[model samples]
Target: MTSTVDTVDPAAAEATEVSRVVISLLKGVVYQSESAQVWTLLRRFQARVTDHMTVMGLDLVIDEAEGYAHLRQATFDEANIPRLVPRHRLSFRVSLLLALLRKRLAEFDATSSDTRLIITRDQIAELLRVHLPDSSNEVRLIGDVDTLIGKVDELGFLRQVKGQEATFEVRRIIKAYIDAQWLADFDARLQAYLASMDGDGEPRG
Candidate 1:
């Protein structure tokens, strides 16, 4: 004699899956490569997850081509509701580093066959150093650049390569933030910034 039992409920399982995916997205970005199972569940229950986010005044942003998903706050013009997400004001150094990286990523995409853009800490320092108005204190400048890189990493635009020293992979999500239009005027904007910094006689942050 054999005893067999089936106890799984389809509706409950699906509901649980959606909840899991929603929670994962709420926590932070869910990358297809980093979280394959969650990404699959998200794609499977995208509508459900989006519906849930909408209820919370949030929107689900997914880039299948880039294989990343995250949550954004929905705009409500008239509704007097407290925001679940906080807006962060990035410092000058962090912003500058991000712009440089975005420009580099664009150039890389145009010339290289590889999608992944890996850069070393020294390379990043050199990229920023050339644009700086002051370079008298090499040690201080390098330290400041490292700090800016750390900020970018915290913002999820740069990921450190495991088992590698001072190497990072530029996350493609940066493209979503710095669009094609931004890149079109990048050179002019960069020159303007440099001119302003030179006039100030001191680099700000």
Candidate 2:
């Protein structure tokens, strides 16, 4: 006698289907359990996904150290039809600050320690002051830095550790966004910006 197979439960089947999509979303990225939305499909199957998305020629940029992930298209040679995504435009100041923060994080990673990457407000001020124009602009500069900091925090590039007003945890996701090649290209631009600053400049000193 042949046995009949029972139909799967509708709810259970739907959950399983969603789980597969979630796994695909997590490909090549380290997802933090706390940050991920509990109800979201991506959070459900994050653990089982590990494969990179190479078929569509996209690089899954994930910084497990920073707890963030984003998709970036893979670079293609001129001989191959170059597929490109629309690049988001960021203000020059914002871009500069992000680059500096990424550089600092890279430096922090090179050091041997389990200590978190921390930077003081004063340190950030100093870094930016050297690259910004000097005048009676100290107050304005501070405000500008504060704005940039807020923006970076919102973008998940920096996290303010509790009770640490002057310090912030620079997220590792910055490294993925600001890759080595981009930094190399911006080196000269940074140098030029630094050279534009006044010798007698002091940021709230």
Candidate 3:
């Protein structure tokens, strides 16, 4: 007995497959190449899907220099009531590190490109160590610094550059997150914090 399979149009089947793949990929955190693939698949569709996504309160942020993209919640308008997402509370150390990194970036922007922006691990340690309480526990201090570094890395504010355990790229995204207004408001507090650190004996050399 011969069996006959039901016939389906090849083009229709391909289109259906592409649609499914694109939708699955857009579930969360889409990058530029992924977005491009989605655009390719949905171009034939009537809806402006990207615009629709924006209307739904998501902003597609693309960093061409970094070659990455991700969706973020759009800032709420004063006219509309606020909607809150679960906030990630950073520790004091992490906050200090972020501020310092932003300040470093500002310094780089002011200086000429001919001068390389270089900050050593020791300098970072020194900058932070004073803020922390003085304890004979050397291991504990090192662990704290490591934890702070890990936190920054997770937030995409710092990228590990070449060299084992040394050197990191302070991502440009930091400037966006830590804006001028916040820095200006915190300047006096930061100055006091640094002065307090200076009052204490210098951090381990």
Instruction: Provide backbone clash counts, one per model.
Output: 0, 0, 0
**Top candidate, metric lDDT:** 1
How many Å off is the CA of 176 in candidate 3?
0.8
Candidate 2's residue-wise lDDT over 11-45, tens digit each?
89766755555454444333454445522444443
Report the C-alpha lDDT of model 3 over 1-205, residue by residue, as the tens digit: 9999999998887767555533543454334443666445454342444465456665555556534444566776554744322356875557778887788777787785632344656666775665555555334555577677778888877767677466676666676678878777667867665444433223222
**Rank by lDDT, descending?**
1, 2, 3
lDDT of each: 0.85, 0.65, 0.60
Model 1 residue 165 lDDT score: 88
Q: Give the TM-score comparing model 3 with the true structure, all chains together.
A: 0.57
Clashing pairs in model 3, backbone N/Cα/C closer than 3 A: none
Error of 1 at 4 (Å): 7.5
Clashes of 3: 0
TM-score of candidate 2 against the unseen true structure:
0.60
